[model samples]
Target: MNNTKDFAKSSWIALVLIVLLNSCGSAVKSTPPPLRSQAEVVSVGQDKVEDSVEKKLENVKIGDAQAYYYYQLAVLSLASGNIEEAVDSFYNAIKLDDKSPFLHTELGKALARKGDLSKAKEACEKALGLDPSYLPARTLLAAVYSGLNEKEEAIKEYEKIIELNPREVQPYILLASLYKERKEYDKALGVLNRWIGRHQNSEVGFYHMGQIYLEMKDYEQAARSFEKAIEENGDFIQGYSALGALYENQKQYQKAAETYERALKVLGDDPRVLDRLLRIYTQLKDYNKALAYAEKLKDMSPEDEEIDVDIGVIYYESKQYGEAEKLFRGYLDEHPENIEVRAYLAATLEENQKYDEALKEWEKVLEQDPKSFDTRIRIGMLLSEQGKHDQAIKMFEKTLELFPDRIRSYILLGASYNQAKRYEEGLQVLQKGLAVNEKDPALLATLNFHIGVSLERLGRFEEALTTFKKVVELDDKHSNAHNYIGYMLAEKGIRLDEALVEIQKALELEPDNGAYIDSLGWVYYQKGMIDEAIRELERAVSLIDDDPVIHEHLGDAYTKKGLFQKAVSAYEKSMKLKPENEEQVQKKLEEARVKLKSQITTHTTGR
Candidate 1:
């Protein structure tokens, strides 16, 4: 059975202001004044000038002095970080001068800072209604809409800001971000392009463009944009990080490592940069370099115990299993109650071939937390490995009881039964697993494969064939399923040609598989290609010398070629290897001996 684990993994701009006023008035005394001479006209003109000055003073007094005072107070409060006071002052200012969009916009900002987004939005909308082209109001409204999750409204406000001031880069950036959040990649790119076109030297714009391209899965353009971002501003740490990630995603480990190394040189041992370097080095299998960076990370964040586990895993992956074991063991010595650390230690012990020690560690883990399904599964696997099938079965059963939906437990239980040669029990367990998760393709494929093995072992040839076919239908890449069907057909002496095709396909998938090679040889023998059969069977035996079945097949091929002496030698080897087939192999050996004696006698008589 396949032990498949499914791991589910805004800108603003200022504009010029122009005020125009028109006044028209007529007085009855104006006709009398027109009759006056130059001197009289001069006197009247002086009076008229004084009257105009008095009217200007009255207009100034009529202006909202209280509103201007409150607006100034709001600005001062905002600058002093008194958001509540700022909001109150701005509200008072707006009440005095309700037509002032700027005052309204300021109120919106203060309200937004105070976390009253709905009121903030209302104030911003009021500002926009008074002066739709007011950049500050539009900017505030966009941000308010974004805070309220009204993305389309936010986009509209941002667009208006851009229209008011195309040179403003913040709006473009904010709009692009909103587009990206909405998954409108093309629109996001369009906005970023506008920003880049306007400000060619903007490293931030290039970096944002790179992010957008990365989200769209345009890796080439993303890489190019990131490169440009770093080129424009070599000190851009985020640019380096993003570029390294892109390389890593494409499996370009060398480039990723180099990018992170460069970042470290510029960034000077930043923990995040060091971690990336460690991961990249690990992927490249440069364990020495990986360990160096990992050490740096540990030093940088010594209190993070997870870093210790990461270091241990790196050591294990690098084949320094003993070192890995010692590291985890050291951690467990201090944190004995840490189940995760203990589990890693157990795995390290298992990898080092200390199965008994590993089993003790797993038991300790279970003692701490009995509901750890992963630990229980590991213990069961260890027991099965030690040939304690009954104990393993109990553990697996207990796991199923605790987590009825854990498909892995069912697979392990069925597989343990298969290993124990309890074919019936294996079949029943796998069928039950299938019933639990009928639609999970991996589980279905695994259960069917095991069921096929059990049915074949129970001498139910037709059922076994059907099961194997079902397995293939579920997972055509199941190489073992292909080999089993081919070998079964060859053994039954039917469909030899089809069997050859199937086995060849299996061999193509796993060219070095001895079982598949043996199946191919058996198919050839059934097809009466004695020489080909002998060649393939010999190769199969060379690949897997301990398999008595391959030896038996080889002997049969030799017997078919009338090479009785070779046949006798092959049969003798098969019998020595597996005495359970002695009865049949002995009869074959006797026939080969008799045939050899008859041939020798016939040759002697003819001479």
Candidate 2:
């Protein structure tokens, strides 16, 4: 055995964040165990070791004196987690007092704790033979059987325990849990129902039933049972949390928040309840409440630096990018090597349009976690966002090379090629993605959409239209495909009525989409609805003012209405924005200027 001095140096536990294993991957509240210094534990443990053996008094009728001494040492060993020594001492105690059922049961418990289940079962059986109604021995035997995966024997023992002690809570709970583990939900429910029949107001039993129903995916029954449990006990924390979680799973944030609030009303500032409120409020975009809970939790556990990351995330989600940036920087100052916090800082900087600074942060994260696929993807996206399409394409192609099974890299690289107008390369990559993701309707739709765009830019109009139609067949609500088809037909001045219908459908799906609105305006212009064309085109410009194409469309609409001065102004604005067809736009601008001059001259002569 190691010296007690070593034991005195390794007892204190450390605290850290508990990242939830939820879809959101959000950090939730966690607290550390109360600090126990090795010195304190050793000091207390030394006393326990020294004084555990009882003094054999004068005629006290204590079972064999040596057995009592060994029993005390066994208990002390067990408490100190010295399982092997505890088992040895327990067996020693039992050998001295062969008929003592308590000693036999204690030995069984030690064996069970040491994971020697077969021996533990034998010892427990010996104890039960000494006293047939010995509850502790029977309980140990049942647990040993369970540990050995002998569910049927465990169930029989539990049934005997329930028959022997019908009013006890644990036997029923244990039996139902065994059945639940085996997915025998009906059996689990039966055990709970049997308990509820005898003890109608058993909140715990009802809660167990609700848990079983939840596993069965009988959500309505789960809710009813949970509600019933809460009605039976207003202070049932488990009931409130479970019901709130159910509502959250259903995306009913308001009702979930209300249930958590009710829990808080009854249970005060319980950490579990507080943490859940933080998550719920964050999801609801109730940043104020989320921050309040975060601050409160920080106050409760000042030593934990993990909460700062979560608080920073809350700010990021709230779109207070400046505040989020500041928080992340401050956290990184203390935890300079924390890749996760640095990544957040990068994202915050990106959202604030500080692209260069964001790139530096992402570079730092990538250097720290070189193999991180997500980090690599983010860096590639940042490059693309800055119109460094070739660099982005190279990065994504490398990502595909490094992680060939990653479908996202193929999609992103294909999109990057299309953005760079490398249409043939984009088509090839997109087709490869489709080949690999044949069964994924959603990915197939996305890849087909990109292929259609490439074909459209390549002037393969019929192929592009067919591909776009295929995207809509895969996903009827694909607004991009609808808009593409509409704009293609309108651009060709053919099927104006069908173009209007397609654009209107796209607008129906995404009413505020500036691109779709511009498509609608162009379709209207094709149909000779010049006034309506101007209205929709102007609305598109208002929504996305930097779009040179929308400006050019507006200029065309003005010229068609013979508003020569307005047409000249719109064309000049389009020229300033550096439209794709610069020479064509310059020609339009010159023509509009000549028309404006002629109109002024005609008006003056008429005056």
Candidate 3:
């Protein structure tokens, strides 16, 4: 075993932090035979004992001295943890001196170690009958009763020990532990409180009380108890740990941070304490503080992957995306098999708008774990935003295959199809979504709106209008339903007044919506309120300068008002911007040319 004194000298703080205190009022030392009590001297006369035994055996050894030899054998074997050999020796001893309580108790312990509980109990009872004051026999008997799940008998034996020796802390500690384990919390607290009163100076009592209070969720009391424990024994690292944890559980981050910071002061440079401080800083959203502590811990324990991840998290949470990505990448370079960190790095890249780089990272994650539904879903969402709807759809479908119960994937795929203008396909996807959750107003509205758009594309205005009405019914404030249905009606020059109402309602819900404003202007134009149409269209055009449809409406309104020069200007602007609509642009350009020619011809004839 490593030298405990050397380990303690190297890091005294680590010694205190690692010394797990038992309820029995003793600290576990960093040595072999872990938490056992100080060794009791079973015998101290090895030379004298050997000489006396040899002298006693001289005459019998030449012929037979089985019982005497077995007694000696049992003592040697028991010391070596050789339970079988000790049992054999104890059997021989018992055959010679059947009333020997010590031999019977030794046999009982060996039987218990060998998992012969019934036989062990019999041996303990026999030892107790021989000598009722044998503490080891009684203790072992209690263990036997416990193993048999005879709780009353176990408690009686433990109580008897307590009555016999009230000053000895083991029985009280053991009894309190049993009560705590059974979740008879009040009873456990009572026993522990009595123990503290008896051993008032012992930090063990206060520490155990704090643990019980913590389990009871009385954080305030637990913290106070821990503080008292620390006050009594400043070297009690566990007191500081529990106090810090109490503050953290209350979400009093500043207090938690302060408590953890204090723990560091008490237990200096402990890696576990430093790691906890890092988390406390994170909870406070003070990532810079977290990073500062994390760097220290990383230097202390360079190979700790969890600390590396913590540093990466601090950077990510602070919005230092580039630095976070670099850390994660470096970590993955060494821990290439760490799928979680790889995935996080990919997410960070995506957040930075580095789509291509992000995709590479994501692909690596998928290579390692092809069945990751979450990663597949993220890939789909990213591709959809980049306008690669086909690839996005495939990714979403794959995610659904992995997690068929994921409702959001279906919703996303439907929206992606709609963005691609495959309205029929979009409607089909949304219909399936509705089947999954029919009463979901948002999903119903989506399905109806897409169905309406599909019908509108096919020039079935009546069917489209009915579908749009259903969408509005499902979600009275569905913005797209109002705009699409209203715009279609305005374009057809039917229900122009009703179309204006729907468009106005849409604009009310989304006042900054240029599309709804354009719809309102178009309705006014269809109703032949040319001046009103000009004002609204000009506002819509200003708000949505890149919308070809708004520019087209503005140009047409100008043409209708006999502002031929302005009309030509608006049409030219629209034509330049809407280069994809070659047929419409050509028609608008011809109309502007005709208007310009008519104005010139009239001016010349008048002159």
lDDT per residue (tens digit) for residues 191-272 in model 3: 7677677664556667777878888888778888888878877777777777787887788778877877777787788887
lDDT of each: 0.79, 0.81, 0.74
Pairs of colliding residues, candidate 3: none
Indicate the residue-level lDDT of 435 in model 1.
Answer: 62
Best-fitting candidate, measured by lDDT? 2
Using TM-score, give the best candidate's number.
2
TM-score of 3: 0.67
Better of 2 and 3 by lDDT: 2
Model 2 C-alpha lDDT per residue in residues 1-607, reported as the tens digit of each score: 6655223213210000000001111221111112245455445544443344343122224379998788777767766778799888878877888898777876775665455668878988998899988777787777677766678998999899888877766678779988998999999989988887887567788788888888889989998988988998887777887899899998999899999989999988887888889998999999999999998888988887788888999999999999888889988999999998999999999999999999999989989988788988999999998999988998898888887766677788888998888989998987787657357777778888998998999999999999999999999899999999999999999999999899999999999999999999999898999999999999999899988888899999999999988898888888999988999999999999999999999999985
Worst 10 residues of 1 by lDDT: 13-22
lDDT of 1 by residue, 1-607 (tens): 3222111001111000000011101111100111244344434433443344434334432149898777667656655567688788878877889998767876776666566778877987898799887777777777667766677888988888778777656677779988998899989988988877766566777888998998888999999998988897788777888899899999999989889888988889998888888888888888889899888888888888778878997999888889898889878778888888888888888988999999999999999998988889999999998999999999988988898886777788888888888989988987888767457776688888988999999999999999999988988888999899999999999988878888988988999998898998899999998899999999999999988888889999999998988999999899889756789989999999999899898889984
Q: Can you rank all candidates by lDDT, best first?
A: 2, 1, 3
Give the TM-score of each candidate: 0.73, 0.84, 0.67
